[model samples]
Structures are given as C-alpha cells and as structure tokens.
Target: MNTLLFCIQNETDAMTALVEVLGQEQTALTQAPSLPLMEEINAVMQRKNQLIASISQLGHTRKNELTRLGFKHPETSMPEWLQDQAQVECWAKLMKLTRKAKELNRVNGLLITKHLIRNQSTLQVLYQNHGSTSTPSLYGANGQSNTQRSTVRGFIAI
Candidate 1:
C-alpha cells in the first residue's frame, strides 16, 4: 500500500516536470533561434527524457506491487488493483496529469513542424530563382490551390 502511494507520488512529480519542460520547450521554439536558447532546448529535451524514464520505472514498480497483491495481469491497468478510495483518487490524478502532458507534447510537436516547414520554405526561396518557369503548387488547409508565383493579370504578346 505504502509502495503504491509512493509510486503514485513519484509518477505525478515526473509528469508535472514533463509538463513544465514541454511548456518551456514551446516557448523556446517560438523565440529567435540562439546558441543559449538552443542549449536550453537541448537541456530541456534531456530533462524530458529523464522524466519519462522515471515515470516508466514508477509504473513498473506499481505493476509489480499490484501483481504481488493478487491483481491479475497488472500490465493491463490499475483499476483492478485499486483497493480503496485513496488509490482510486491517485490513479485518477495520474491519468489526468498524463493526459495533460501528452496534449502539451502534441502542441510542441506542431510548433516544431511549423518551424521546420518555414525554414525549408526560406531555404527554397534563397536557393531558387524567383523568375523560374517552373512553379511549385500545394493545397492550403482550406483545400485551396496555392501557387508559388503570382498570377499575371494581362496576357503577354507573343
């Protein structure tokens, strides 16, 4: 019982740390790219990895405890092993925190994707000639056709 409580606390702390780090990462992603910010991103990434590993370890500990307490197939879930209201509350809180962390991570991923696409577009514009005959086209989010070149208003003489 005590072990389960401790595991829950550890998992929650790791999850909270993950949420905070991901928020910091999102901020860093939006800021102007700099050496110090890059270093901070790297550091935050390392911290995120450590927190994930710690949470995983805590999960394993809880599973072991549940299994020892005669809960069948503890790997499946924790509800089967929840013996009291306190355990139920702990499990609920853990689930909530994990959900929040996942959402933040997803938002951060989108931000990174936007940055990557912007950089790629900038490089393409820099390396390619603007007056080139070939025009690249893609669809926008609204399903509208988007061309790299501007449309000519008047017909040109042959």
Candidate 2:
C-alpha cells in the first residue's frame, strides 16, 4: 500500500510536468512559426516525451503493486483497494492530473493540425500561381529565367 501510494504520487508529479510542457507547446504553436520558435517547440516535445514515459512506468509499477496485493484486475479494483483515505486522495489527485494532461495534449494536437492546414493552403496557392501562364517565371540558380524549363510546360509536353 505504501509503495502504491508512492507510485501514484510519482505518476501525478510526472503528469503535472507533462501538463506544464504541453502548455509551453500550446504557446509555441500559437506563435508565428520561426526558426527559434521551432527549436523551442522541439525541446518542449522532447521533455514531454520523457515525462510521458516516466508517467507510464510509474503507472505500471502501481498496477503491479496492486496485483501483488491480490487485486485480480488492478485497473478496475484500484479504487476498492485504496482503503486508506490518504491512498484514495492520492489516487484521485493522480486521476485529476491525468485528465488535465490529456486535455492539454488534445488541444496541442488541434493547434498542430491547424498549422498544417494553413501551411498546406499556402503551398497550394503557391503551386497554383507557379502553374499560371500570367505569373512571371522565377530566376534559376544560373540567374536565367525558368520560363523555358517550367515544370508546367514540361508536363504538358510529356
């Protein structure tokens, strides 16, 4: 029981850290994309991954402890096995933290999706303009007009 409580508390702490990192990710996603911001987001993601792994390990340890204590199905029997008030409270706190982390992660995923959509839209527009006859051809690496070697013209010939 003592070990279970300790494991639960550790899981909760890791979840708290995860939520914090997710918040940072959310903030970074909301900002305009830049080289430095992208670097920061990458760092936040790395930390988030580490926290998630720690939380998963702690959860497994807690479940194993419950099994050792004679709970047939640790997940469903955890509440019942938590006879002590402190144990119950710790479990509840861990549950609450888990919920928070999940919500933050969901929101972060949505933000990332939004960014991808925006980027795709921009790329589509660029492609359309590049293929348009009225649009001027861009200069090639050798400082010559790319009109003669246009991909749209080459595709049409093929």
Candidate 3:
C-alpha cells in the first residue's frame, strides 16, 4: 500500500513536470517561428518525452505493487482497492494532473498542426512562383550568366 502510494506520488510529480513542459511548448508554438525558438521547443519536447516515460514506468511500478497487494486486475480494480483516505486523495490528484497534462498536450498538438498547415501553404506559394517562368527568378546573379538556376520546385513536391 505504501509502495503503491509512493509510486503514485512519483507518477504525479512526473505528470506535473510534463504539464509544465507542455505549457512551454504551447508558449513556443504561439510565438513567431524562429530557429532559436524551434530549438527551444525541441528541447522542451525531449524533456516532455522523458517525463512521459518516467510516468509510465512509475505507473507500472504502482500496478506491480497493487498486484502484490492481491488485486488481480489492478487497472480496473484500483479504484475499489484504494480504501484509505490518503491513497484515494493521492490517486485523485494524480488523475487530475493526468487530465491537465493531456489537455495541454492536445492544445500543443493543435498549435503544431496549425503551424505545419501555414508552412505548407507558404511552401506551395513559393513552389508555384518558382516554377512560373513569368515570375522573375529570386535567385542567380543579376548580370552574371549562370549555368544552372536553383529551383525550389524540386525540393517541394506540393
């Protein structure tokens, strides 16, 4: 019981950390896109991944402890098994944190998708302009003869 509570607390802590990282991700995603901001977001994502893994491991440990406590199917039976007030409160807090983290993650994912769509639209426009012979080439020297003109059409299929 004590071990299970400890595992729950650890998982809760990890989830809390993950929520904070997700908040950072949300902030980064909402800001103007830049190389440095992208790097920071990447770092935050890595930390978030680590926290998720840690939480998963702690959850497994909590399940094992529950099994040792004689709950056959701990996943479904945990609610019924948590009779003590402290354990119940801790489990409730953990669940609340989990939901908060999940919501933050969902919002961040939407923001990323929004950014991706915007980037893809920009790329499509650039591709169209690059392929059009009528549009003046943005690349190449103004006066010098160039053997090959770099084209973005090849790079972006869409």
Candidate 4:
C-alpha cells in the first residue's frame, strides 16, 4: 500500500511536469522561429526533449496501471507528437541514409577492383626490381600483402 502511494505521488508529479514542459514547447513552436537558424535548432531540440519526457511519463503511468502486485516495466501507447508527418519523414530519411551508405560502399569495392587491374603491371615491375620473388596474383585489391600498407584500414574511405 505504501509503495503504491509513493508510486502514485511520483506518477502525478511526473505527469504534471511533463504536461507543463509540453505546454511550453507548444507555445515555443507556435512562436516564430528566431533568426540565424540556431534558435530554431535549439527550439527543435527543446521540443524533442519535452516530447521524450511526456512519452516517458505516459509510459510510466500506463505501466503502473497495468503492473502486477510487484514488478513493472511499464507499457505505453504511442505519443501524440509522433503522429506528425515530419517525424515520420525524419525516420524515413535516416533509413534512406543507411541504404545510401551501403550503396556507396558497394561502389567503392568495384572501384578498388578496377584500381587493382590498372596497377597490376606496375606492381609486378616494382616487385621484380626489388628482387622480391613473392608478388601474389592481385585480384580486386584484396590478395596484396597489406603488411606494407599503413596501419589504417580503408583510410581513404569517407
């Protein structure tokens, strides 16, 4: 009983705090974006924080309600802010960026193949001049003895 009361108090306090913060954020978002873009950036950050807090509080409340007589992980429904198209678009863009990076990496591997083919004759001549008998048949920049290369891996990749 005592623990329940404590949790109730905490839950009420957190709900009130989140509501206040969200109200302030809504007001701020409604106001004009400040000059220089930095202010808008900061406001966006603040709003994000507020949204997180609100979602956390709502989750906690829902969890408390559904919790067994003891332990709780706390369940939560979706937050209102997430219903916005901009939020969905942001998530989509992040996913797209990951895909683009993968495509770029694939292209880099193909370019490395081309580079190995183009440099094979020169590498063979250099190996002969140095009297090194072991110059592995190079294919796709991979069989080359990387011991002579720098400690960095894929150093040229952005």
lDDT (Cα, tens digit) per residue for candidate 1, span 42-80: 999999999888889888898887788777888776766
> Which residue pairs overlap in candidate 4's backbone?
none
Alpha-carbon local distance difference test for all models: 0.80, 0.82, 0.82, 0.48
Clash count list over all predictions: 0, 0, 0, 0
lDDT of prediction 2: 0.82
List candidate 2 stretches off by more than 4 Å. Answer: 130-158
Writing each residue's lDDT as its tens digit, candidate 4 over 76-117 gives: 322322345654554344345445434544554565466567
Model 2: per-residue Cα lDDT at residue 110: 95
Question: What is the Å distance of residue 97 in model 3 from its true position?
Answer: 0.6
Full ranking by TM-score:
2, 3, 1, 4
Q: On a 0 to 100 scale, what is the lDDT of residue 141 in model 3?
A: 73
TM-scores, all models, native as reference: 0.75, 0.82, 0.81, 0.30
Error of 3 at 143 (Å): 20
Query: Candidate 3, which ten residues in sequence have the lowest lDDT sum?
Result: 149-158
Clashes of 2: 0
